[model samples]
Target: MIRTLQSGQQCQVRIASVTGESTLLYSTHRILLEAPNWTLDGRSLILNGDGKLWRLDITSGTLIEIPLGGIPDLNNDHVLAPDGESIFLSANDGHIYRAPLTGGHAQRITPDDGSFHFLHGVSPDGAELAYVGIGGGDFRQPGRLMTIASDGGAPARVNVGEGHCDGPEYSPDGKWLYLNTESFSTEPGHAQLARIRVDGTGFEQLLESKTVDWFPHLSPDGQYASYIRFPSGTQGHPADLPVAVVLVSTGDWKTPLHTWPLFGGQGTLNVNSWSPDSEHFAYVAYPPATQTED
Candidate 1:
């Protein structure tokens, strides 16, 4: 189901620089926006709201809808294609679609194999995609790491373990798929940052923490990463929570270089939002409107 802001709540679009500065790019109470994707040219940010795609021009602050044909309402799971002119979208109908960035007919990529496809990353070479598949659309079943050709084919499962995982994004070098998984913990919903080889070997946990982490997105240059940290006992990345977006050096993921505390989850930093230059990344925040002194 598409989620909306409750009365008196507001959505904020923000960018955080690796050098430790934060900027509020835009905000609204009219609609709930989430999961920003920085365009390859660094001129705009792509976001989704009300089951549709929107592009926000950073310089002019113009927000426009990118129309799509032959696709269901979109979810927060979307990734920019490596080509810079197209995107891969995971619609609410349990299928992934490819559409031009300029907006046009969306070509369905998943083969309807009785699994729900949630898109995360496109390979650096643009030949493959990494995502999480929920078998038979069952929430009770653990999600499995999946990969498929960018043009569409039978998806292959990359075994990390028998646990729920999400945000299987490719490292900028095309060697590792970064994600958060429950395999490291016996505690339910205790997803920790992890990475596995594209060939399905060398699975390693990146960090150890009581906080439930989700979505470890690497910068385009592969120097830094950003992820959302939920409360210790939070289950399944729920919305409207007090979450923190932590930035860390890829070489030493244990120590945080910076952290931005905000009121959002689920839709905040679910995808890679790093600018092409890798200097800045974007995210969303949903906070209640402040009471006015009338």
Candidate 2:
């Protein structure tokens, strides 16, 4: 059974597995739903819609709203903590929060700093949080990759070149944090995939190309990494575009084991969504709505 809201999204939401099977899990007609994070048990998916969060049961295809009382301005930037006990969310106000996985009052982790913080991933041991921080309302400016204590404290900037750094994910072992950086806001096409240490050192470039690459998620088994690539000259990964999800061998796995074309870019797979077994991952696709004769 495919569920849809009558007013919000321009298209429908789909759960596409790596085995090439895609299903219409949910949709909204009034509010746009974006960004999905998989559960550690692989039984459900948690996503944000209308400034609130929802849990979608993978087996029953049911949608349940998580009661986020205090955090009314939640964004798509969220990830399940490694402990599988709590969830961290980046609200629209640019502050980070920790809440119960089942949903409740969220505790703000970052202070009321002027800079905006959008969370990318939580450390393996769930102690550090890596995110991109920058001045608010100016999306064109390059962002800095930084980390903070998961509980709440001053943030330390990761040692990366001055550029637009985003989509920071930690390796399973908590040694390397993978991220993408592009020099100058003028040349957005130069985005390259790279990884650095949690202490802000030992940085190395992983992949570089003319095409813009964003959101690289390593598999749970520590064998492969998957990410999304955008077309030439696109900035900030605009929505409703042709994109491909590429899978690469992490530790001598291989290069480009699989890449699938889809119709979503920015909010498709912003968080670590690999399943527990490491066989297939989950991603959302926004397909175009049927043309109505206007």
Candidate 3:
């Protein structure tokens, strides 16, 4: 469970347990939590706050700050390697770094050639990494999805075209790469969830939504795909609210197995990581605020 607090005119995040029957998991104050990614063992959480990486131990309720070496300016969306040994994080300097999970120096994996690269997912075997590379000098321009070996090699483009692609994740079997494609438009801005073969063929659309839908994560069991869905009519503003987490069946994308409300809306409430058992997922939820008259 997550909670939100009112900080003057803004909101902050607070982490709690999902079980409603337990009062021990509740928090009396809200903290600035964002972009929570789970360790492979589900015993810890990795999140970005204060422009730095933090590891939280669930059992001990301790928060340990991890230094990002020389690379700073990493937003949320940092993923832990499948072995839980290393962390892949994207820096504001247009590069990706691999660092030890226990807090040490981070080695620059991707080149800082002024092209933006965002780290999204690591293969279950920890051999490959899926990322989105934006063209031009800035990341806001058009981009495509690409995958490269963890040891560093030639990156292969999995999706190519004029459409903007973001949030790439690999299936549990490591056969398919899931992502969201957004065409530059103001009319509804259709964003669809898609999957492509690792070999860069057989691209297929799994789901479509009028509002923005991204951050696709395949459950550990390979049964469901969980994503964040922003409701229609709210776009390109801080007033936008994440409505729910839509869980779609892997075999059939037409139907949703479950939909849960995010409750809080101001802060980042996107789904970033899943438990190893695939039963429960972790997300950051901020407290909702009273609506003001326009």
TM-score of 1: 0.98
Clashing pairs in 2: 5-27, 5-28, 5-29, 6-29, 7-29, 7-30, 8-29, 8-30, 8-31
Worst 10 residues of 1 by lDDT: 285-294
- The candidate scoring highest on lDDT is 1
TM-score of each: 0.98, 0.89, 0.83
For residues 12-120, what per-residue lDDT tens digits would candidate 1 score against the true structure?
Answer: 8998999988888888889899899999999999999999999999998789999999999999999999889999999999999999999999999999899999999
Give all candidates' CA lDDT scores.
Answer: 0.94, 0.78, 0.66
What is the C-alpha local distance difference test score of candidate 1? 0.94
What is the per-residue lDDT of model 3 for residues 217-240, given as tens digits with 9 covering 90 to 100? Answer: 887888767777777764421333
Q: Give the TM-score of candidate 2.
A: 0.89
Ranking by TM-score: 1, 2, 3
The C-alpha stretches of model 1 lying farther than 4 A from their native spots are 290-294
What is residue 276's positional error in candidate 2, in angstroms?
Answer: 1.3
Pairs that clash in candidate 3: 1-17, 4-287
